[model samples]
Target: MTRGTTNPNRLRRVDRWMAWALGDLLRRSESAPVVVDLGYGASPVTVLELAGRLRAVREDVRLVGVEIDPERVARGEAVADPPRVEFALGGFEVPVPDGARPSVVRAFNVLRQYAEEDTPGAWARVVGRLAAGGVLVDGTCDEIGRLATWVDVWAAGSGTSRAGVGPGRGGVGPANAPVPHSLTLSWRLAGLETPSVIAERLPKVLIHRNVPGEGVHALMNALDRAWAVQAPLASYGARQRFVATARSLRDEGWPVLHGPARWRLGEISVAWEAVAPR
Candidate 1:
């Protein structure tokens, strides 16, 4: 179990991104899509916050906050509104009501507590529980969530897999490993520093891999360089500076996804191959 450290609005960045990125998935569901918040900690505030944000995407979206600790589950149950927002006592098995398959399983700040080598197994287990076309968002953010990075993992045959990638490069692994699709970085631009600082908040699979000769390391270096190149834009605003930085990376072929629309919000996403472990 995690230390259960959390704060109000600590996950607003990722929550906003998920609401936008997965809007179609949520809206097109034949039934009210199920969304799971695996390992929501001591407080259910974030879970409640997530439920509120997702309702903007689909009013009937169901939320299930899963935790291994019974006490945490009990805490969540206290505030949970049955059917709309609920809590379950479980681990990566991801138990949900009525055996409903979740369309998105968010395991943020959860896997960082485990050994790096154990990441793939945990990912596979969570992804296994997702509904078809579902996505697993594995992420880590600072206490206040000013800095955050997450990788989007998809299940095999989910039709969400990136094209032209082979095993271990955002593709399948030796066993029933999840297919990582992309990496996204988000920052609160009000008082930001170097983009490389996000390296400290990388998700578990790529955290220790942030060294020389690794893809993630190279991406960090490139982002830092781009940030420098776009430094002049800072005089206009941090948003302008960040958008320019993202444009620079894309201009140099970093496989950066999204456009200035997202970058303007102090965010950028890149295909996982751009930063997959070497």
Candidate 2:
């Protein structure tokens, strides 16, 4: 087990993003949608918070916090409400009751301790346990949640295209491998510097790839340039500056997703192709 380090609301940004971006998936589930908070750490607060937020999207949504450490699972069990919120003991081979597949798996800061080369295999194993149309949010963030980056991964299937770069030194994995659809970078925006500050917090696949000749490097450079160009808007607020930055990136042919509403929240999501590791 890696360090179970955590803090209250430390994951609020990603939780908010998921509830907004994946609300439809939860609502459309025929059965109560299942969401897994993989490696919830020592406190149950984050998973509990996730349950509260997601229940707004679908009241019947189920939450399962999985950890390899039984002590942590016991800690989660201490506060869990059975059938609604619960904890399980498992690793990348996600084990759910009755073989229930999860609609979404939020694995934040879990892979930080793992070898980069093991990422694709771990992703494949976890994505294989996902319900159809499900997604795996593999992310990394700072201790207080100031800066964050994540990849939206999907299992290979019909309609799935080779979207982003693969894990480790590989470009893209096999056609049948799990693929990333997009990359999301988020910030607190309170004391933000250049957008490239997030490079250090990028998900495992892109972290080491943030160097010369890489798409992620180019993306960070472009983001820093855009942030500088919009520096004047900081007087209005960092939100305004960030929105302008997003717009600038979009104007420059970057496949930035979402609009001002999300941008105003210090979030910018782009198609994986735009920032995929070269």
Best by lDDT: 1
Residue pairs with colliding backbones in model 2 are none
Q: Model 1: runs farther than 4 Å from truth?
A: 160-177
User: How high is the lDDT of residue 233 in model 1?
Assistant: 86
Tell me the TM-score of each prediction against the true structure. 0.94, 0.92
Please give the CA lDDT of all the candidate structures: 0.87, 0.85
Tens-place lDDT digits, model 2, residues 13-120:
899988887887777789999999998888888899999999988999999999999999999999999799989999888777667999899999999788888898
Model 1: per-residue Cα lDDT over 18-130, one tens digit each: 88888777787899999999988889888999999999989999999999999999999999898999999999999998999999999989999999999988888888888
Q: Residue 9 in model 1: shift from native, Å?
A: 0.3
lDDT for predicted candidate 1 compared with the true structure: 0.87
User: Least lDDT summed over 10 consecutive residues: which range in candidate 2?
Assistant: 160-169
